[model samples]
Target: MEALFERVFVETTVDTDQDGQYDLIAVYIKRPKLDEKVPAVFVANPYMLHCNEDWYDLYDVNTNIQAYPSQNIQREDVTFYQKDPVVCPKKEAEQIVENSPYPEPDPSAYECISDLYGHLLERGYAGVFSGGLGTRGSDGLTMTGSEEEIFAFKSVIDWLNGRARAFRDKTRTVQVLASWCTGSVAMSARSYLGTMCIGVATTGVEGLKTILPEAGISNWYEYYRHNGLTLPAMDWQGDDLDILAKYCFSRALDPNDFASIKPLFEKNQKTLQEGEDRQSGNYNRFWDERNYLQHADRIQASVFVLQGLNDWNVKPDQGIRLYEKLQELGKDRMMLLHQGQHIYTYHLEDSPTLGLIDRWLDYYLKGIDTGIQNESKIYIENNLDQKLWMQEEVWPPKSYKSYRVQGNGNQMIVDDLSQTIYDRKQKNTKAWLDELVLTQNAHSLSFDLETMKEDTRFAGRAKVSFRARIQQPTAILSAMLVEKGKQVRLTPNLDGDENHSFVFKMEEKPSDYFVITRGWMNAQNRLNNYSKEAIDPDTWYTYSFDFVSNDYTIPKGHTLSLILYGMDVDQTQLPFVVTEIEVDTASIVCDCPIE
Candidate 1:
């Protein structure tokens, strides 16, 4: 068998001076003959052409390098050597040379042709190159346009694919792995190429903003200057990047220390016009960008997104909604929400939520079927048990049952019972109009049941059906659940002020041991139509409605109580009212037979 290798050098000139000296030089190794069986690798270098002395020293002594028989070719067969390599001017080389002696060299420095050649050969990769926008020496990093970046990425794939046909005459599938923003751009391109793209969120210009702020540095450029950290010219940007960097740095500090600057990031959430501020626009933009609705359709990969739920800038809801959209789009994707903010943290290493991301990515990328695709696998920490609970269905399952509210005196029981009441309007039907003023502290009337013979479990949605005449034109109805001799459990109100009959759905409750479900109607919407089985919409009627369902387990000794009331129950919010009312059991049944 014969081995083939080709060496090529690229010299980039900044000016058309025709001088022998070139502004930049690059070396490349092409093994077009061996392209079929190996992965294509590209190493890019923005500075320097030859191997650094340290790398040469390692090459001379390291057993790993010596063990590779293929890399050590016969001296006679070696075709290329630089007789008198042009070096950078002494003054310019001083800074570059001084920083070269560090224990660990910048990974970018080793992106030369020979270094990349050795890496690919040692790793058994066949395709390799060292050209891109910067190959022509036009400030490769920043000066590289988005189009050129796209082209460079495509060229790498093309070159590799080209080799497969030329070398082995067999077509091979290619996969790409990119670092930094290059990964983001490459992944975007991969979407067009119909290839799977795997990339790392690398440290680069964006990283500087995050890193510098955490280090207590107010200004990124200033920090670099004072700390002697090398600033790659490609990292340099206009004022937008600088401003963003400063903003990020300021936000990195604790809110207490920088209370004044907090408003800059915060959005004004007030509903009234008088409370409006600059934060309003900022918030709108933030929500617009962070909202799942924005990129609901753009995601093309089997995205495994790991976002910090506690991230101040990017809320957990953002990722949650994105995951939901992906599910809606029927894309193969997963999302992991952790307790840490913005970036992954070592401090949270021992945290249980931290491993969720690792497990998810491992299962998706590594082709390990870890059962992550199961329906609604939300691992929520149970506040009661302090352990993660895996739910098969959605969080707070929909199979809850609501027990209709029935009353004997002030006592409430979970049962179905009819109450004949006087119609307030006609004052003729077996209905009585009882006027109750709507107040903030309006007591929710309850119908208590007789002592239970056996325990019962009630879990699901609960509601209250009532018929009453409103003295005023409009009012608000609110319902709440309360354990016997305890405060109200969960309270939710109707959407708006109205004078009509309607059914309100309580937010789903977790399965638990409980006695009753309760309901309430705003006295203002007291109009009810007794002609239909449900309350009427046109005119006021007479009947205090208590309808509750879902599911709850009643212990043997506990009594089930149903309470109905009018007015907003959230103490922090404003209040409303309800007028006349009559209490009765609502006759609504679940479609599915409850056990």
Candidate 2:
């Protein structure tokens, strides 16, 4: 498709940094020549303009977990911020990208979204891209998923509809306009870029007709912390909201810009550090601002949620939760689930995931009558067998049943989990399974389910509840469901073309055990994420929480093991306290979903 015209400009947004000067957002636009204006596909990402080669700044998680008050305390939860995540920035701008994360993206990063946008151009649609504050060409601090970040993105759509202003360059004297756009916009991207799609849609932004967020986050709290634990999203530890903000602070890459904004940028980083509350790992107003699920009621756009069932980075739960909420709101919504780990669905062969997206956008953006809205609302790559796809009106399917499994052994166990279980660098999961689940640790307890009568499909979080009398004021306890078997687990397509992508490979050595799901809680925060009260020593209290969301089929003859332990070595913050808890086995029953 030959472009009729293309332009790069800057749009102004509120001074989230409180730097007196308004923040400048960098925009790149392209459109196929046509007599009539056309709808546009939009992408707002921080990585486009510039990316830090390295950003290691993180909170000190090795420090002791903070103690709760004798009585419960909940921070004033700020669901909607009155002010943008007031950031800090000083600027000298640059020039940048398009409807994709890159006009020409890294091959690894390039996928169906870019391809789809290019295809749209051939169909007479336009494409536009922009970066928010603190990106290389944009002005303002990068607060990661801050309120300001969301607004900065919304402003671009506003600009396309002529609700806001844009200048041809950094100097505001001359102006430019997206006169070629039809005001209807759709957002399509992956990962962090996908996250921006969800954030802006929550505002019910006028021009946004639809949002296709692939592997995006709905709640920053759930991303960084879970059930009151500072859980890292696979791979690295110590990476928090502050570190993420630091990584996207690309305006500093320019030496002159760095000299001007370093101090203010550091100040913004400090605010993030304090607001994130790394010590407690509890939900607060700061996280509330980045959460989109709570504001789903405000969304007026149709949403196509895409998720990798095996994705550990963003996890399978984030998109599903948003899908569920949209369902409750009775809004237009659809879900596409795959077997891949943190990957684009463009590669899935049998289903042709990207084709569905093309139809979705065509219907939403152009009002095309594709009959897509009448199709099954949920689609998933079956885990029981690779390359097989499944579709139904709802997830967990109508055949879903709960199987209860309980243990009758001793419940009293004590161990100081603050000590390291392995050399810090030794993060091999098979070894962790050996040391923490299969081979018994003095501080952990494992109970087994009867062998499966048939190959049952297990899908959804397991509900675990137990009454425990603890001797400590504060403690961390965990529960996990492991599949005990000698079976090869099919991993999602890694990097490969379509023909080779469908050929599945084993994720790990065929082993005797594989952990299916896990749940952890700060015993004090039994009521919810916000409220926490120190435990009255020796008093019995019931704790209940869902295991991390999961979808898999436990094989026939494979017994499911329910392991209760202290301090998750892989997912929680550490406290150096020698703690003990007496559990009532009768009060413990794990309810797992089955089909």
Candidate 3:
């Protein structure tokens, strides 16, 4: 076992902080001891290798030692962060300390990724793990999803393919190379690690044969913010790259590594600060660099994307939107959407999804005739029945019916515009449902659509449109699709800080009923995402936005309910604005494809 694995640091060509010195990538390798070259699976992550926490439960800590050969890289360039003692403020420093319970682990220690590493090795495949730019023992400042970070990753492939230079130490004292690599690399990981894989795969780097990204982010903007709205801490939230990079790289328990890398860490703070405009929460050049789908045409590798339809953190839109672009470009791709949250389906109990992934990697990485290419391009799991799976040629049901419901105060007609005034007291505090259920509350409107005569499934993004006018400069538009029947399917659980506790928890709880999908939009972001359009006091404006996408079936005889609220006190911190919505019952519509 000892002979099968080795760890080393590969120097990347990109100058992360533009200090003229190249960044180094710390990597762990495990492969067969046989004399045959093998395709490698590269796991590029910023957490495990970079963070203080040691989650990789490999061997007993007492018995494990640093068996891999390594060299001490000396730092010649110094920066402000290295010289400064208090780089982070008291509040920011406390946040990192409170969340991370584990003490810092030694970077020199060689620990294996218990299940994933060994499983691939047993299958005659080599595996590599490298901390993203500034994480772990790697050199340079960490910028999450930055061009520099992605290029650093590309450098790793360059090294494996004999296109780049690596070293044994900073002195360039000894040169080392990937002598045993076949150069056909596949990247796979979940969440942030998975995002790195997709980010680099967009470069179309040679030798990157395929990628399997699970719950990976294709666009950084969509991951942390919606169309133009910043996501609350409860759903999808993260700090700026500078803070996050420092959180991961600065807490160096290894005194030597910290001393050498501190300057680079401080240099990163300036770049990250200048790079992102966190306050605007709008799409710009900054996010464009982080969006991999924009450069999907450059990808030379096959892609297998995994997403959870119910995931609110890194929502399904991140993967599905990218999948659509790849499909349009005639790229070879496959997708699986399940009824899970932000999780790796392969790790689920007795999951057959794991076998599907194995066959995918085998066909592309090993050049095996697994017949995976002949299989359907999309696999969708039923929310109600985990055992039931449906295979399709494309996502979002190519042929489907559209249902439109218009609701007035008295009745909901199929095509009539309804006029209603929503004017709840601006200063009222209550639960989201309690406010909605109180029909007397002028701010909320609940509509009961016609019951389903037969079972119907809506597959794809839901579009809600209506003509509305608000009294204030800004207002929040929130729509909730509820399935009211004899039983409930989803159980609503509240979690997170006081500001976001109003959101329904998507996981763990069980019930017969559940909200299908909810859509939220700020009144100002209606016309242009970057600029705000003022309302003409009482004049109505037609507004439409997509709710999160979903593929769910409504049981027969169930009445579909549409609940609209002018403002959610729980989600927004600003003062409430009363909203007046005018609709010829038919003018208001909740359009969804019936699959």
- Best-matching candidate per TM-score: 2
Task: Return the lDDT, model 1, position 61.
Answer: 9
Best by the lDDT measure: 2
CA lDDT, every prediction?
Answer: 0.28, 0.76, 0.64
Lowest-lDDT window of 10 residues in candidate 2? 93-102
- Name the better of 1 and 2 by TM-score: 2
Alpha-carbon RMSD, each predicted model: 25.0, 4.1, 13.0
Query: What ranking emerges by lDDT with the best candidate at the front?
Result: 2, 3, 1
Across 190-242, the per-residue lDDT of candidate 3 in tens digits comes to: 77778888988988899999998887888876665454555432321233444
Runs of candidate 3 exceeding 4 Å displacement: 1-3, 50-114, 232-243, 250-267, 270-275, 347-350, 398-403, 409-441, 488-512, 566-586
Range of the 10 consecutive residues with the lowest summed lDDT in candidate 1: 58-67
Q: Write the per-residue lDDT of candidate 2 for residues 318-436, one digit (tens) a residue.
A: 99889889988999999988877777656456765868887888899888999999999988777768667778676556343454445575477675753435543454545565777
TM-score rank, highest first?
Answer: 2, 3, 1
Model 1 lDDT, residue 428, Cα: 33
TM-score of each: 0.32, 0.90, 0.79
Better of 2 and 3 by lDDT: 2
Alpha carbon lDDT of residue 184, candidate 2? 94
Error of 2 at 509 (Å): 5.1
Off by over 4 Å in 1: 1-179, 182-352, 362-371, 374-376, 380-384, 388-390, 394-398, 407-442, 447-468, 483-538, 541-561, 569-572, 576-595
